[model samples]
Target: ILEEHAFVDELAEREIPVVPASRIDGRTLHSFAGYRFSVFPRRGGRAPELGDSATLEWIGRFIGRIHAVGALTPFQHRPALNPQTFGRDPFDYLRNHGFLPPELAATWASVVEQALEGVARCYERAGELPLLRLHGDCHGGNVLWTPDGPHFVDFDDSRMGPAVQDLWMLLSGERQEMVGQMADVLAGYEDFCDFHPRQLYLVEALRTLRLIHYSAWLAMRWDDPAFPAAFPWFNTQRYWQDRILELREQVALMDEPPLWPV
Candidate 1:
C-alpha cells in the first residue's frame, strides 16, 4: 500500500495528471474513504477508448517519460512472474487446486525450464542494463481513454524491474505482432528505459509461461459440467500444446542470438 502511494505521489510531483489514488494500509481497496486524494470526473461518463493511433502516440510519449522517472528512482519491488491474486510461486498454488494431473504438471515445469534457460542467454547477450521501476503489468485493459488522453489505472502491480517486463505483456495475446501499433508504446517507454531484443524475448517467454501456467490453473478450478465450461482441462490441454509448439518454433529461431539493443 505504501508503494502505491509513493508511485502516485511521484507522478503527481512530476505534474502528471493521474487519477487521484492512494492506499489505506490494510484497508479495502473498494472504499473511497481510503484514497488520499480526490480528483475525479463527471459521474457515469463513458470510459475513454485507447485504440486509435493518436492515442497510441500520446501513450508512447507518456511511457517514455515513465521510463525516465524509473531511471532516476530504483524500483521498490521485485520482478515477479505471477499476478497478486494468484499468490507467489503459482505452480505450487496450481498443484494444491486439485485440477492439474501429473502429466500437466510435468509439461508446465518443462516449459518454465526452457524459458529460464532462455533468460540466462538473454542476460549473457544484453549484459547488465539499467534497472527501472515499471507498471509490471501493462496489458490493454489497464489503459483508459480520458479527456486528457490515455490515463493508466491499476498500479497495484507496479514494481521495480526490467522495462521489457512491461513490453512483454503488451506484446502478448492478440497484439503479438501489432509491433507497428506498439512502436508508440515502445517510443513512450524508451524515453526512460531501454532493453535488448534478447531481453525482450526472454521477458516475453516468461510472460507466456505465466499464461500457460494460469490457464491450467483456471481449467482446474472451472472444470465442471453444471457450472458451464470456462475452460475445461481437455480444451485447455490442447491449447497449451499448441502454444508450446509455437514457443518451440520461436526458440528454435533464437538458436542464433537475436540482434540485441534494438
Candidate 2:
C-alpha cells in the first residue's frame, strides 16, 4: 500500500493528474485491531466519455505522461504483471481447491489450458518487449472526469508491466472501432512517450490471462459474505461453461493479427 501511495505521490508531484491517497501524521497506512488501512480523500466525478474522440485522446495523453514518469525507475516492492502471477497461479489455485463444479471441471481445465497456451504464443511473438512500471489496472472504471479532465484513482494494482497493459482496457467494440480508438489514444500518447509496436501482440494474451484470473479470484473470495452476495452467479456450472466459451473465443482472437494504429 505504501509503495502504491508513494508511486502516486511521485506522479502527483510531477503534475500528472492522479488521486493519491492522503497520509495521516506522515504515514499513509494505519493499523487498527491488526487490520491495516489507508484513507483517500473523497472524490467525485463521472466516468470519462470514451466514445468521444477527444476524450480518448485526452486519456491517452494522461497515460502517456504517466508512463514517461513510470519508466524512470523500477518498483522494488511491487510485483510484475506476468503469466505466472496473473494466469498460472490463479489457475492452480482454482484447480487445487476443487472450486469448479464436478460436471465442468474437466472441460474448464482443458479450455483454460488451451487459453494459456495461446497466451504463451503471444509472448513468443512479442519477444523482448519493454517492461515498465504501469497502472496495471487502467480500465475506464478507474478514471473519473470532472470539468477539467480525467483523474486516475486506485493505484492498488500498480505493477511493472508493458505500457500497453495500461492502454488495452480502454478499447472495445469491433476491430475497426478499436483500431480507431487506438489511433486516437496513440496520437496523444506519443506526444509524451514512444510506443512499441510489438507489445500489440500481448493485448489478447493479457485479456485471456485476466479471464482466467477473474474466475480464480471469485472462487478464492467466495468465503467472504460480501463476495457471494455481490457475485451470486460465480462458481456456478453456467459460469464455468460461459468462461470455457469465452476462453475458446479468446484462443481464436489470439491467432488473429495484432491491431494496427491508424
Candidate 3:
C-alpha cells in the first residue's frame, strides 16, 4: 500500500505517465482504486516485442529511470512471507511439493542446485559493489503503457533487494537470446544501481525462487472457482515447476555442499 502510494508520488513527481493515484477506501485490506486503469496501450505490447530495436531502447530507458528512483529511495514494502528466507530454495520448493513430476526430479534438482551456487557466487561478487532498494518485481504485468511509452504499476512487492530481482522478471521470458537481452537490461539498470555479476545471479535465484513459491501457492489455490486459470502454475507445465530447480542444480554441482560458509 505504501509502495503503491510512493510509486504514484515518485512517478508523478518525475512526470512519468504512471497510473493515477489511489486512496485507501473505508473497507478492510486498505482497498483503493486508481483513477486511471490501463487499456494496456497496445494489445500485444510486451517485453517480447523487444525484438524491435526501438521497443528495446524504450524499455531500456524506462527501466533505467525506474531503477534510478530505487537508488534515490530507501523505503520499501516488504512481503508478508519471503520464500527465499523460509522455503528451501527454488529447487527444494518443487521437490518437496507435488509441483514436479517424479521423472524430472533428479534433473530439476541438479539444475536448480547449480543456479543456487551461482547465486551464492554472485553475492560474493556483489560484495565489491554498492547495494540499494529495487522494484523487487519488474515484469510485464506490472508494466503498462500509455500514449507516451511504458509505465510501471503495482509496487506492492517493492523491496531493498538485489536489482537483478527486478531485471530477472523483466528479462525472463521466451524471447530469443533472453540472456543477451538480460545483459542489455542490466546495462540499462546499471545507469542507476551499478550492476555487479553477483547481484545478477542473486536476483536470478531470488526471482526463480519466488516463482517456485508462487507456483506452489497457485497450485494449492487453483481449485478455487474465483481463481483464474491463466497463472503459469495452473497450467501444469513441467518447465514451470522445473525451471528454477534446474538452475539450482548448476549451482550445487559447482562446489561441494558447504555446511557452513560465509
Candidate 4:
C-alpha cells in the first residue's frame, strides 16, 4: 500500500493529474482489527466521453506521461501482469473448486485451455516487449474528467506490464472504430513516450485473462454478503455458458491481426 501511495506521490510531483492517497498522521495505510486500509480524498468528476477523438487524445497524453515516468524505475515489490498471476492461477482456482456447472464443466475446461493457448500465441507474436509500471486497470471508471481535464484515480491494481496494458481498455466498438481511436490516442501519446506496435497483439490476450480472472475474483469474494447481492447471476449455468462463449470469441480475436493506428 505504501509503495502504491509513493507512486501516486511521485506522479503528483511530476505534475501529472492523478489523485494520490491521503495520509493519516503521515501514514498512507492504517491498521484496524485485522484489515489494513488507505484513504483517498473524494474527487468529483464524471467518466470522460471516450467516443470523442479529442477526449481520447487528451486522456492518452496523460496516460503516456504516466507511462513515461513509470518507465524511469521498476517497482521493487509489485508483481508483473503475467500468465501465471492473471491467467493460469485463476483458471486453476476455478478448476480445483469445481465452480462450473456439471453440464458445462467439461466444455468450459476445454475452451479455457484453448483460450490460454491463444494468449500464449499472442505473447509469442509480441516477442520480447518492454515492461513498465502501469495503472494495470486503466478503464473508463478509473478516470474522472472535469472542466479542466481528466485525472487518474485508483492505483490499487497498479503493477508492471506493457504500456499498452494501460491503453487497450479505453478502446471499444468495432475494429475500424477502435483503429481510429487508437490513432487519436497514439498521436498524443507519442508526444511523451514511444509506443510499440507489437504490444497490440496482447489486446485480446489480456482481455481473455481478465475474463478468466474475473470469475475467480467473484468466487473468492462469494462469502462477502455484498458480492452475493450485487452478483446474484454469478455461479449460474448461464453465466458460465456466456463466459465460455466469450473466451471462444477471444480465441478467434487473438488470431486476427493486431489493431494498428489509423
Candidate 5:
C-alpha cells in the first residue's frame, strides 16, 4: 500500500489525472489495530464507454500522459510484469496444489506449456523492452470519466513494465476491430509519449499471461470465503475445460502478427 501511495504521488506530482491518497494529519497511511488504512476521498465518475471513438481517443491521451511520466523513472520495489512472474511462478503453484481436475490435468498442462512457448516467441520478437513504471491493471473499469477527463484509480496493481501493459487492456473486439481501436488510441497516445511498434508483439502474449495469473490467483484465494462464494465455477470440470479452450485460442492468437498501429 505504501508503494501504491508513492507511485500515485509520483503521478500526482506530474499533474496526471489520478486519485491520490488523502493525507490524514500529514500521514498518508494510518496504522490501527494491526491493519493499515488509507483515506481516499470518494470521487464521482462513471465507467468509460470504450466503444465511443471520441472517448477512446480522449482516454488514450491521458494514458499517454501517464506513460510520459512513467517512462521518466523506475519503481523501487514493484515487480516487473514478465513471463516468469506472471506465467511460471503462478503455474508452479497451481500445479503443486493440484488445482486442475485429475482427468483434465494433462490436457491443461499441455496447453499451458504451449501457451508459454508462444509467449516466449512473442517476447523474443519484442526484444529488450523499455521498461517503465505502469498502471499495471489499466482496464476501462479503473478509468472513471468525468466532464474534465478520466481519473485513474487503483494503484494497488501498479508495477514496473512496458507501456503496452497499460495500453493493451483498452483494446477489445475482433482482430480487425482491435486494429481500428489501436489507431484511435495511438492517435492520442502518440501526442505525449513515443510508442514502439515492436511492443505490439506482447499484446496477445500478455493476455495469455494474465489468463494464467488469474487462474492461479483464483486458486490461491480459494481458502478465503469470498472466493468460493464469488467464483463458484472455479476448480470445476467445466472451468478447466473452458480454460483449456481459452489457452488453445491464445496460442493461436499469439502466433498471429501483432496489431500494429497504422
Candidate 6:
C-alpha cells in the first residue's frame, strides 16, 4: 500500500493525469485493527471511448509522459511483470492446486504450454528490452476521461516491465484494426517517449501471460469464499474450454508479425 501511494505521488509530480493520494492528517497511510488504509481524492469522469481515434491519441500523450517518467528510474520494491511471474508461476500453481476441471486439465495444460513457448519465442526475439515501472493493468477501465483528458488511477498493479505492457491493452479488434490503433496511440505516445519497436513482438505474448496469470489469480483466491461466489463462472469446464481456445489463439497470434507501427 505504501509503495502504491508513493508511486501515485511520483507520477502526479510529473504532471501525469493521475489522481493523487490524499493524506490523512498529514499521513498517507493509516493502520487500525491490524489493517492498513489509504485515501485518494475522488476524480470524476467516464471511461474513455477507446473507439475514438482522437481519444486514443490523447491518451497516448499522457501515457507517453508517464513512460518517460517511468524510464527515468527503476521500481525498487515492486515485482516485475515477466514470464516467470505472469506465466510459469501461475501455470505451476493452477496445475498443482487442482483448479483445472478434470476433463479439460490435459487440454488446458497443453494449450498453456504452447502459449508459454510462444511467449518465450517473442521474448527471445525482442531480446532483453529495458524494464521500467508501468501501469500494470492499463485498460480503459483504469482511465477516466473528460473533455480535458484522461486521468490514470489504481497504482496497486504498478510493476517493472516493458512499456508495451502499458500499451497493448489499448488495442482491440482484428490485426489490421489493432495496427491502426497502435498508430493512433503512438502518434501521441512518441511525442514524449521513445518507443522500442521490438517490444511490439511481446504484445500478444504479454496478453497470453495475462490470460494464464488471471486464472491462477482467481484460483489462489478461491478459498476466500467471496472468490467462489463472485467468480462462480470460474473453474467450470466451460471456463477451461474458453481458456484453451483463448490460449490457442494467442499462440498463433504471437507467431504472427507484430503491429509494425502502421
lDDT of 5 by residue, 201-223 (tens): 99999999999999998999999
> 2 or 3, which is superior by TM-score?
2
User: What lDDT does each candidate get?
Assistant: 0.55, 0.90, 0.54, 0.91, 0.90, 0.89
TM-score versus the correct structure, for each prediction:
0.65, 0.97, 0.62, 0.97, 0.96, 0.96
Per-residue lDDT, model 6, residue 184, is 92
Candidate 4: tens digits of C-alpha lDDT, residues 41-140:
8998999999999999999999999999999988989878988789999999999987898899999999999999999999998989889989999999
For model 4 the TM-score comes to 0.97
- Tens-digit lDDT track of model 6 for 1-262: 6666777788888778898778778889888899877777888889898888999999999899888888887878888999999999999999999988888889889899998999999999999899888989999999998878899988888999999999899988988899889889999999999888999989999999999999999988888989888989998888889899999889888988888741
Off by over 4 Å in 4: none
Question: Which should have the higher TM-score, number 3 or number 4?
Answer: 4
Q: Is candidate 4 or candidate 5 better by TM-score?
A: 4
RMSD of each: 6.0, 1.2, 6.8, 1.3, 1.5, 1.5
In the range 71-189, model 3's lDDT, one tens digit per residue, is 77566445432335423553454576675667666665666555555655655644754445555566777766545577766565666655556666655444345656765665555
**Top model number, lDDT:** 4
Off by over 4 Å in 5: none
Candidate 6 regions off by >4 Å?
none
Q: Which tens-of-lDDT digit does each residue in 57-170 have in candidate 1? A: 676676666666766776455444432323234545555565444566567556645654554555565666566777766666766665766666666677666566665555
